[model samples]
Target: MELNILAVGDVVSPAGVKYLRTMLRKLKQQYCVDFCVVNGENAAMVGLTPSHADEILDAGADVITLGNHTWNCRDIVPMMEDCPYLLRPANFPPQQPGRGWGIFETKAGPVAVVNLIGRCDMAFGPDNPFLLMEKLLPQLDTKLILVDFHAEATSEKLAMGYHLDGRVSAVWGTHTHVPTADCQILPQGTGYITDLGMTGPARSILGVLPEQSVAGFRGELTSRFKAAPGPCKLEGAVFTIDTATGRCVHAEGVRIHEN
Candidate 1:
């Protein structure tokens, strides 16, 4: 049997949320998606809250993964514990409020989903994701495993893809907010991509207003950053997994501009 899974990129703002709410279901149907995961750390422009997570879930996200900004909203700390489908990076301290991985029962079968952050050049320090996976992978009972490797560096993301190539069903990168052209199945049957890009404003710098990002880069602004205004775009990937063998049969990048 083949299982179709859609992994969406970071949702950046209210506009992005609106776009997902309006279009995700249609996309799922169009692709015959059996499962869905969404990176939603930036759903609130800066961080995510419980309400924002709810919005994404209601919009059709079966699992919501978070990244570096995972703790920007205190309310999410508790929500993460209560919401089984919401995940923070597993490499975080064990005492962290929420879990880093979960197993969800889907029509296709049970799928294990993991969220991990990269340590190199990241804003916050976390345990080694590679080592953490070594311990976590063996614990999962399911073979249809999907990982959201949220990192800033392409090297780290690529290393992770190769490391888990034959072990997991797919490893999709996030956090960079720029989609890469390289989307392919690894030699060992894993689907991989450097980044899934951002699901937010089409005319912005990584979902933030270009002017704001430029000002910050130029050291001319100290104000808080804001999401840009305009049409939204959704970027991500669709993975087709061979459930019988727990291998990814196909993977493709997907980008849609809001009409």
Candidate 2:
């Protein structure tokens, strides 16, 4: 008893969306993935008129998780609330706009997915996610659990992963555009990755204009950040989990270039 889960990093722009929409289904088929998830915080980064969060879902994503940039356009919050598949952040605050975690009915069973954020170097409220999960998780009745820990610091993300190991099926980190080298199944049968990376103009500086990023660092001036218009790349991973044992049999990272 198992399921194929493909978790993507951030989708940064229209090009990123187009590319992911074009390739994800094929990728899922090739990998025999059961469910697909993506971080859509940057889908409207380059532009906002064509907020294609739905388009990405139409393509194949079962769930789309967001981060602090989730509120970048201001229009997405309400829309996210209307849809359970699109999450802002669970650990945001009890009264926040969108839900932090949910369960989707699948052929395998109901898969519970939790969306959490880290406190270090991020806009997080006083609510402690570690405590919140401990309190709220038992109420859910799914053993095949997965989490997208969106955070800025690697240490905090790893800490949370370790804390939740053996309890959850997988814990994959996001928010950071760069994917880390660490992707492994925990001793307790939990799949872990420091970061899934972003699917965007990969050559740029973390999805932003390299020139602007460099100028801001070099000069004492505050520069308006923007996304770079160029070739894009998709970064994510497939967590092949053995449900009976709750261990990952296969852990592979993928990168698709818009060439």
Q: Model 1, which residues run further than 4 Å from truth?
A: none
lDDT tens digits, residue span 31-135, model 2: 898998888877887322225888889989999887777666876767766888887678776776778888998778888888887788864463677888898
Stretch of 10 with least lDDT, candidate 1: 216-225
Which 10 successive residues of model 2 have the least lDDT summed?
A: 42-51
lDDT of 2: 0.82
| Candidate 1 Cα lDDT to native | 0.94
Tens-digit lDDT track of model 1 for 1-259: 9999999999998889889998899999999999999999899987898888999999999999999999988888888888999999999999989999999998877999999999989877899999999999989999899999999999999999999999999999999899999999999999999999989999999999898899888989458888899999999999999999889999999999976
CA shift of 107, model 1, Å = 1.7
Overall lDDT per candidate, in order of appearance: 0.94, 0.82
By lDDT, the best candidate is: 1
Pairs that collide in candidate 1 are: none
- State every prediction's TM-score relative to the real structure: 0.98, 0.94
The alpha-carbon deviation from the true structure for residue 5 of candidate 1, after best TM-score superposition, in angstroms, is 0.6
